[model samples]
Structure formats: structure tokens, C-alpha cells
Target chain A: MSTQIEQQETETEADEETEPEVESPGERRRAQRDERQAIEEAQRETEEASLDDENTITLKVFRYDPEVEGKQEPRFDDFRVPFHKGMTVLDALIYARDHYDSSLTFRHSCRQAVCGSDALFVNGKQRLGCKTQMSELDDPVRIEPLPHQEVVKDLVVDMEHFYDQMEAVEPYFDADETPDDKLEEQRQTRENREKVKMSTRCIWCGACMSSCNIAAGDNEYLGPAAINKAYRFAMDEREGENRKQERLRIIEQEHGVWRCQTQFSCTEVCPKDIPLTEHIQELKREAVKNNLKFW
Target chain B: MAQHYSSFDRGGRRWLFQRLTAVFLIGVLAFHFMLLHFVNHAADLTFLGTQARMSQVSYFATMWLFLVTATFHGVNGVYNALVNQGLTGSRKNAVKYLLGIAGLLLVVQGTRVSLAMTTLV
Candidate 1:
């Protein structure tokens, strides 16, 4: 009985008003229905918005420094940032530091994602701080340094290891012959670039590398980010056929593609929407294919 | 060559068995609860009462089944959970073997208790 009454009320809310004069009965009825629907949707949206606005958020930022005395141990600092229209957690961090304390440190360059800095652990997930909007964050956003690496400073991890892994993959196109015209860029088919375009989109953010559990446990493991880098160059037809075997050999190393345990963490954290695990798995298939051919 | 063993990994299989054992244990637990709380006329529990039940073939089978399933489910599930939490290399292998031995000992000891109750041994 209560359910029927509730349903009736819901229906009444759907078709409550009509702004435009309707001469025909069918059009009048539609306008009335649309008005009701718009009113109901508006009411629902307002209710949802009020619920979200009522939620006051607090951010807990981890503080640590190798040089600072008296505070040898790592600790967390808490800040309450007021939520506003289209505000992001990165904006909140900036707000906190500028308004509250100058000592709070983080690395951010080219506030846009083109530079790829400001990746950090926001609520136990690796996310690009600049790109992640704040309203989406659950109350008490717990910010920490990216896991599975030596922290050089707050939110600034040593990228030398990541660079080494990327370099190890030989991330350069190796074509034996120079083009007839040295000035002209080499012609690549549209389809060829499309196949490996996603792999090339990696900005070396290191989020995928940090999220991987296997890479954390085993230091030598060529993390997902590196393997994807290799894929970008290797899969490019422009690199030529002569280098394919060498590229395969690079990925087939003991600490290479085989070490990935496929926990799906790398895929989840990638901001560029790069399918890191799929690329890694495809490389494994390629490596195995080469091995079978050799036999 | 290792064949792909269904979608269930070692951890997933253990999880499935843990749920299965829990279901089995519920029936056994009910029987146990009824025998102790309702069937037994006296309030006190004795070794003789256990022996009397174990002496029956049906009771012996039920007890042995319950004991084996419970130990395997409980111990293996624990080991699987540990492995999922990043246990690898020799340390992971060592825990695997240690837990194997512990599980074997428990099953043997538990089976003996059931045997002593029924004379089925």
C-alpha cells in the first residue's frame, strides 16, 4: 500500500507543469509530462548536490625529509580544504600550501598533463594529481608518496631507475638506411602508427611502474611502463624489419616480460588509458613466438 | 608444459573449498550441537559419551569427514591468503612446506581422536 502511494507520488512528480501553451491534447500531455520529468530530475539532482555539499573533506598529507632534524621519522600532516565548484585534489594541495604552510612540498610542472609530473598516491590509488578532480574524492583524502620506490623527497620519487628500464628497451627507431632526403621525415602508414599509437602515449609518469606489486618485490623486473615503452618502438613498422629480432631479445630477458604477475594494478592506475597489461602480455606472446621459431 | 587449470588459481580453489567446508561444517555443527545440548541427558560431557558415538560406523564417518574438511579448508585458506599478500621466493616455499607439514599433523591427530572414539582404526 505504501509502495503504491510512493509510486503515485513519483508519477505525479514526473508530469507536473507545462510552460508553453499547447493547443493539441497529445502535445499538451507531452509538454506536461516533460515538465514533470524535468521537475523530478531537477529535484533529484538538487537532493544529490545537497548531499555532496554537506560532506566536508579533510586531506592527510605524508611529510618526510632526509635532511630535517628533530623529525627523523615520517609522519602525516592533516589539512581541511573547503570544497568548491569543479575543484581537484591538486588544487586543494596548492590551496593548503599557499594559504597554510610553505614548507609543504611537491613537484608539479605544466599544470596540464603534457608534462606528466605530480603523480601521487591519492586515497591508496596512484593518480595524476593535476588531472584528478577533488569533488570525486571520498571524505578525508589520504595522500602519500607513490609506493614501491625510494622517495627522494615528498611526492618526488627517483626516476633514474625508470629511465634505466626505458633505455634498456632501446626506445629508438633503428632504420639501417637514411632517407634520400635527410630533411624530410620518414613516411609511415596511418594504420601502422595506429596499431602502436596507444603504447607511445605514455608520458613516463611512472604510475604504472609504482602500482605493480611484482616490480616492487623484484627490483630487476622490467616494469609495465618500460615494456610499454619498448612496444612503442618495436611495434612501429618505421623501425624496420632488421631490428625485430634484437627488440624481441630485449624483451625476452629473465627479468623482463616474464616477471609480470598480472595483478591488473598497472592498468588501473594509468591516466593515459594505456593498456599496460595487454601490451605486456602481447610482448610475452611475441617472445614465445620468437623462441618457438628459433627451435 | 603446464596446462591452464580453470579460472580458479591456487588461492581461488582454496577459497572455494573454504566455503564448501563451511557448508559441510554447518550440518556437522548442528549434529554436534544437538548431541551435546539436546541428546545427552546429563549436563557433563565425558570421554565415554564420545567413545559411544564414535563406536557407531555412521558417527565415525561423519566425524572423520568433518575433521579432514575443517583442517584442510582452514589451514590451506590461511596459506593462500598469505601468498596473495606478496609471499614469494624461498620464504613463500618455506611457508608452503611448513603449512603442509602442520596440516598433515593436524589431520593425523584429528583422525586418531575420531578412531579412538569409534574403534574404526
Candidate 2:
């Protein structure tokens, strides 16, 4: 009885293997033709759907180059790019660069908003190109380098001054003590981490700095980004109270947190959604509190 | 690298003063406008009526304080705006002194005007 059952199972397996070869050549051809026709129909539907005028977007890109003869006089170049769902400003710019003109210049990397390289003045506001969705912007979207920074060349601003201000803040952790055990790491409370977490999100994209009217006016003003950087470390529990005092002193200068007018533009334009004015305001309070202790 | 611990570097005082003065001005200015425009009416204001209001010690004191605060706020605002525009060195110093003189003149003249009003009433 077991031999009979095994033989029946083997026969079924052989039938499955020979099933494909059993089909006639004419039937196989007809099946292949049906498959090709279905694929073509899908392709046709997609093409027809994308044929609408609304599916294209126009971009007015700022063009300038002191070295290049033609672009020496600043001008705007119009680029018409096909619109797709979930497309970003960075995608449109990349398409324009590749298909329209190879000489079009801009800085971008990691395309994921972490590198902070592609902050641009879009429609008169500071925005991250990669993070901003094209569908949200008006047609003929205007793209330009950040205002108040020296334009290096088309869509690229000289970031040296911004870097200098960021460096001036000493954007690093400096704790006075370490654990006795060599393997132990500094422990921070959940509340402390939560406090500084928003400030720590800053990617140094310079968007907040560019949006700030105070930063644009006062060259020496530490700017929102730097102050926020100071806030991240100053508010950390592991940094010790002494280090916090030192940080406060650095940010309480004439051109430091004092220069902020609570304009709220920095907070509004922050790509990371950091409450910059709040941070600066907090630092101001801390400085005053620290100063009053002398009395 | 050398840390300067000068008291003059304290911008917190000025920022606090700006906010404090703003709050005070909002109340006093509103009262002033209401008194002159709504309660008393500006068209019917006479020298005697003006004097009648100014002669009160509290009113006189408030007006004097208003004059001082307004001058400071205005001049300081202009100075800050200029500094934000990258004013530096001798130019900044020159603007500072000029604004200081202007503020002093405004306050002195304002006091004189108030005193004359009181005497006339």
C-alpha cells in the first residue's frame, strides 16, 4: 500500500513538469502577444494621463557668474520641467541641470536634508531645496541663492562667514568630569535629552541665519544657528553647571543673544523647526539669572 | 580668547528696558490718547484745559516719564537698526553721539513745553 501511494505522488510530479511542454506553439505565441498588448495598454494610459498642461511646472532660476561673459549681468533662466507626484525642488533643479544646461551650478549632497548644502531662497523665503515639495510651490517658482550672503556663482553663496560664526560658538561638548570607570559613559536624564533634542536637530543649513533680519543687519551677531548650537550643549545635563555658566558668558556678549529682537523669522524659517527665538530668549534669561547672583 | 568682563557688555539690561518701556508706553499712550481724543476732545482743547491736566502732579510725572522713555526707545531703535546695517568704528561712534544729543534736546524741550503749559493754566 505504501509503494502504491509513492508511485502516485511521483506520477503527479512528472505531470506538473511536462505541463508547459504540452502547450502548442500557436497557443504560446498568442499568450505572449496578449501579455505584450496589456503592457502597451498600461503604457498608453500613463502617457495619456501625463498629457495635461497642469503636469508641467515652470521654474525661474537665478543665473549669475562674474567670470562667465554671458552670465556676468545677472538674469533669470526659465526651465520647464515635467511635474510628478512627490517631486522635490531639488529634483527639478537636477533635471534642469542635466537636460537644459550642464553649466548650471549649485551645491547638494546626501539629497536627504541631512547635509544642509542646498538651502536656497525660494519664492522670497529660505527653504531647503531637497525637503520642499514642488507641488506646494506656485508655478514659475523662483530659485535664488540665500540673501545677504555673497553669491559665489549661480545658486551658490559663499558660506565662509556663516562657517566662521558657527565656529566662533565652539560647537562641541566640554564636560569637567568623567566617570571613574574607564568603560562608563556620561549618563543624561531623559528630561535633559528631551530639552536639547530640538536644538540638536539643526543641520547648519544656514536657512535660519539667512531668514533672520537681525543676523542680516548685524555682522557680529552670533546668529540664530550659533546661539541654538550653544543652547544644545548649555542645556545638556552632563556638561556640568560650571560649563553651562561659561557657555552663557560666550552667548551674552553685546552682539550675542542680546541682538535678537524676537522677530520670530528665524523660528519660522528653520528647516528643522527649532524654536530659535525661544532658545535665545532662554539664554538671555539664564545670563540675567547668572548675573544677578553677584548681588 | 581673552574674556572681557566689562559691565558695559551687558545687553540684557537694555533688552529688558526695551520690553519694560514698551509695556509702560502701551498703557500710558493709550490713556493719553483717550484723554485727549475721546474724553476731552482735541478740537475743544484750550490752554487752560491743557494746564488743568498738566497741573496734576501725577499727570505731570507721567508725561515727563513718557517723554524720557519715548526718546530712549526711538533713539535706541534707530541706533540698533543702524548697527544691524553693519555700522562700525568711527561711523558708529558718530551716530551714537548724534542720537544722544538729539535725545537730550528732545527731553529738555519737552520738559520746557510741559512747564510752560502748567504755568499758563
Candidate 3:
């Protein structure tokens, strides 16, 4: 990939020399310097691209097999993909598989942000590959698997634990009692609906959970995503008094609301703008108030 | 998930009592030291001195308040520190509940001891 990038640069340089120079001394010198700087930056970018750059999008995928490896040291693999207008990191990965190496693996579905698949460490932050455009990033976008998760393969993280924590909260709502058929539509205040509407928007993407430092050491923690799940129902007026108290009890467990340290990372990374910290704080207040009533 | 399980949960009350007692003891201990050591030294102690202080109901009340606050504060602070260190699971919960019951008993006994020391006895 480096040789190809070098070859492309030399060819461009040779083409520049062939063209007749024009303009005044000052203008020509500045233009030449700018052109040289641009070429150097492009070359430097390609070199830094894959951890190995070629002339294309260099992807440095980290590989580790916890079971098969002797010492389990991570290594990067390189691939140069043809650049396209508005090409996404996911698009580049797909192109790498079709052309260079078929074994280069990653996850994607729906090819849209809604599926919550294709979340990779694009540079140093968690981002959905389908949503991040290649043109918006420097050459050879450094694609690695998400951190704090067991990688099943190249880019696919084992989401079983994430799923289990989510399920433990029983994400499905259990209403107090069915509304009478005589009164088909249940009435709710507009203010109450809006208050919990943000919490209800959580997609269970586990993006917030992965960023939380608290969840890193404690496996018992229900995590921000699950706590937000509890908040959704707990704050909902439609759930009624019986179900509301039940939701509160779930969140009031030892590994629940008290576990949150108001870190706000959960709120920052929530794709749906769920206001996770605010909801967790409210749950903590609810827990405190519930205790005080006994006095 | 159960209804109002937090009522019996002792986490918040311990947190509050520890902080409150720490604040109270700062003032009460300073006042008690000045009165006991410098203002009315043990060399000048007498039944007249004891009667003079205890007869004033406010002074007797303050003495009991200091003891009750210090006992609850010191014991509950130890409990909160243990809990914040990842105390969970059934066995830990059993120990926690036992500690809570023991703490309540201590508070009851300590209050009685403080009342007995005061003129209220």
C-alpha cells in the first residue's frame, strides 16, 4: 500500500514538472510550496493510514484470539480500499472484503443507523460505521472493534451480556390492570407523557453501557441502558401506581440507582438523547423519598 | 420489583446520620471540652458544681444530645463505609441486616446511658 501511494505521488510530481511554470515570482513560489505541502500531507496520511497505507482507504483492524494466541498480543491488519464520494467506513470495510482479503470481517445490517450494528472504534470514539462518512475523516480510517466487550470476531462484539442486563429489568411494561372495556382509551396528562418520553426513546443500543467506567469493574451493575429502561416505565403515568412502585423497587436494588455516580457519559453517548443522567438522578431521589416516608 | 421496598432499606438513613452526626459533634465536642477542661477544671469539681449544671435542664439536655449523636454517628459511619465497598449477595445482605439490627440496639442502649448520666435519671 505504501509503495502504491509513493508511486501515485511520484507520478503526480512528474506531471507537475511537465507543466510549464507561469505567474510572478511570489505567486509561483507560494503556489509551489502549497502544492508540495498538500502532496506531503497526502503521502504522510497514507503512510499513517493503516498502522500501513497504500493509495486507498487503509483500515488497521486489531486482531486477537484470547484462546488461540500464545501471549494474546493485538496486531493490526491493513487494507487499501478505493475511495468513493460519501463512502462510509462500513462501505470501505465491505470493499476491502470484495477486493483485497475476503476474511476481513465486520458487522452491518439495514445499512442505516437504526440497526445499531457496525459500532466501531472509528479513531478513538464509539461511532456507527454506517453513519460516519469516509470523506469526513483522515485517510485510512483506523477501524477497531469496540472496547470493554469480548470480540467474537473482527468487528462483532458479544452482545449477550448487554442483552442479559437489559432483559433482567424486564424491558416490557407490566401495567397495573387492564382498563375497563367501558372506557376504551386510558387518559393521561400531556405533561406526564412528555416527562418520560425521552427515557422511552432508548433503543437498547448499549453504547452508553460500554462507555460507563462504573460498569467496567462491576458485572452486577444493571448499567445505564437498563437503568434507563427502568426509568422509562417508572416515570410513565400510564403504568399506574402498582406498576410504578414495582419499577422503583427494581431500580432501588443495591446494584441499581446507587451504583450510578452521575458521570453523564451515558447521557452524552445516548443516540436518542435519552437524558440518562437526569433519569437516574430522579430515580435516586425517588429511592430517598420512598425511604423517608417510612419515618 | 416490589412496592416501596426502599422503606425497610437502610442505605440512605445511614448516609444521612453519619454526615449529620459528624457536623453536630464538631460543635458539641468543642463546647464540651472548653467547659470541662479550662472553664470548670476537675480540680474545682464538687456536688455544688454538678448540681449547679444539672439543675439547668438545658445543660442536662445538651449532655445527652452529645452522647446520642456521637454514638449513632460513629457506629453508622463504619456501617456506610463497609456497604460502599461492594457489599452484596445473600450472605453479605444477611450480615448487613444483622449489623443494622445491632446498630439499632446500640442506639437504644446508648440513648438510655446518656439519659441516665443526665439529671433526667
Candidate 3 lDDT over residue span B1-121, tens digit each? 2222344343555544665788889999999889988999978887767767865788877766776787677665555445444555686678767876876787688666555555546
lDDT of every model, 2 decimals: 0.76, 0.86, 0.73
Q: What digit string (tens of lDDT, one per residue) describes model 3 on residues A36-60?
A: 6667657656544544233457777
Q: In each prediction, how many residue pairs overlap at the backbone (N, C-alpha, C within less than 3 A)?
A: 7, 1, 1
Would candidate 3 be rated incorrect, acceptable, medium or high by CAPRI criteria? incorrect
Model 3 lDDT at residue B103 = 68
For each candidate, report its DockQ versus the true two-chain complex: 0.02, 0.34, 0.09
Estimate, for each residue in B59-82, the C-alpha lDDT of model 1 and write its tens digit.
888888988887887787677555
Best by lDDT: 2
> lDDT tens string, model 1, A3-122?
357557767654443434445888877776776666555664554356443544688998887888743578888886667677777888887786567778888887777677888999
Write down the worst ten-residue block by lDDT for model 1 chain A: A13-22
Full-model lDDT, candidate 3: 0.73
TM-score of chain A of each: 0.79, 0.82, 0.74
Comparing 1 and 2 by DockQ, which wins? 2
Which RMSD does model 3 reach against the true structure? 11.8
Best candidate per DockQ, number? 2
DockQ of candidate 3?
0.09
Instruction: Estimate, for each residue in A1-295, the C-alpha lDDT of model 2 and write its tens digit.
Output: 6535754665555555545775786876666556555555565456545656678888999999999999999999998777889999999999888767889999999889999999999999999999999999998899999998999899999988888888777899888787789589888999999999999999999999898887887788889999999999999989898888888877888888988888899899888899999999999988888887875
